[model samples]
Target: MSDVLVAVETVSRAKQLKAATGALHEALDARMMGADLFSSRDRYALFLAMQRRLHAGIAPLYGEPALAALVPDLPGRAKLVEIDRDFADIGATPPADEPVFVDPKDVPAALGWLYVAEGSSLGAAFLLKAAEALGLSVEHGARHLAAHPEGRGLHWRRFTQALDAVELTEAEEARAEAAAVVAFRRVSRIAEETLAGA
Candidate 1:
C-alpha cells in the first residue's frame, strides 16, 4: 500500500491520471469470477460499479479546464482509448457454441482462465506502458494455474528458468516485453481451438 503511493502525485494532474488509469486496469484484470462460481448478473453488476467509479474519477481530470490544458492531449486520450478497447474485449460474450460447464471442480479454474485471458491482456499492457512512461525497468508478469492456497504453489524455479531464457535473449531489459509475452500466451491458449480450426 505504501509502495503504491510512491508513484502517486497529488499536485500534478498528469500523474493522477496515470495512477487512476493504472488502478482501474489493475482492478479489471483481477480474477473475479468463474463459470459456475458466480452468476453473470452478479459479475456484470460488479463490473458496472467499477466502470462508474473509474469514469467518475478520471472525468474531471480529463474534462476540466486547467488540468487538461496542461497535460498533452493525444497521449492521455490514446491511453483512455486503449483501456476502453480492453474493457470491450473483456465484456464480449464468450462463444455460444462451446460447452459452458465442464468438471464442477474445475469451474474455478475456468473462471480464473477467463479472467486471465480478458483481464491480463489489457492489465499487463497498461502497467507495462505506465512503467515505461516512468522509465522503470522492473519486469512484471503473472501466471494462473491450477493450485490450492494451502497446497503446493507454482514451480518457481522452473518458471524463473523460462523467464531467464527470455531475458537472456532480449537486448534491452523491458518490463513491457515480458508482460506482452505473458498476455499473448494467455489469450492464445484460450483461443487455440478456434485458431487451429481456422
Candidate 2:
C-alpha cells in the first residue's frame, strides 16, 4: 500500500474510503456530465440506462453471504427497480448490450464495492433536483434519486457503522481501496460510453 492508503487505514473505514477515492469520484463525476443529461428526455433516459448498467455490475456483491452477514440490508438497496420506473416514465428501454460486471472476490472487496454504492445515495439529493429540472420526480420518475426510505443521512450512518465494524488487515484494506477505485472507473466507463453514443 502507498503512504496515503496507509494513512487512511488509521481512520474509520468509511472515512478511509472517502479519502482514498475522492479524486476518482471527482474525476468520474466531471466526466459523467453533459448538457444532454439534464436537458432532454432522450438523453436523460440514456443517463438512467448508464446508471442501471453500473448498478447491475455491482448487484451481485449485495448477495454475497459474507457481506450479508455484515450488512443485512444490502439486498434491499438495489436501484434497479427504481431505475426501471424512471425508464418507464421516460418511455425508454435499456440498451441491448450485455451489462458490465464487477466481481469482488472476498469480504474486503465486497465492502469496497458496497462503499461506492451506498455512498452514492448521499449525493442523490442533488440528482433528484436535477431530475426535477427535467420534469421528473419521485412519483413519476427519478425514483432512484428519491431520498431513501429511512432518510439518506440515517441510512448512510447505519451503513457506515456496519462498515466500520468489520475488521480487516492492512492487505485487505488495500484491496478494499482498490475495489472502490475500480468501481468508480467502471461507472465512468459506462457513462462515457453511454454519453458518447447519445
The global Cα lDDT (0 to 1) of model 1 is: 0.30
Taking the tens digit of each residue's C-alpha lDDT, what string does model 2 give over 67-92?
88888788778787788777888888
Give the CA lDDT, 0 to 100, for residue 31 in model 2.
Answer: 69
Q: Per-residue CA lDDT of candidate 1, range 1-198, in tens?
A: 455535663333212223334543344334332221123333432332333333322333344333223222312321233333433434533232222222212222221222223233233333344333433222211111112233222332222232233222222222323333333343334333332432
| TM-score for each of the candidates | 0.23, 0.88
Candidate 1, clashing residue pairs?
Answer: 34-111
User: Against the true structure, whose TM-score is highest?
Assistant: 2
What TM-score quantifies how close candidate 1 is to the native fold? 0.23
Q: What is the C-alpha lDDT of each candidate?
A: 0.30, 0.81
Off by over 4 Å in 1: 1-39, 74-198
Q: Tell me which residue pairs clash in candidate 2.
A: none
Please state the error at residue 160 of candidate 1 in Å: 29
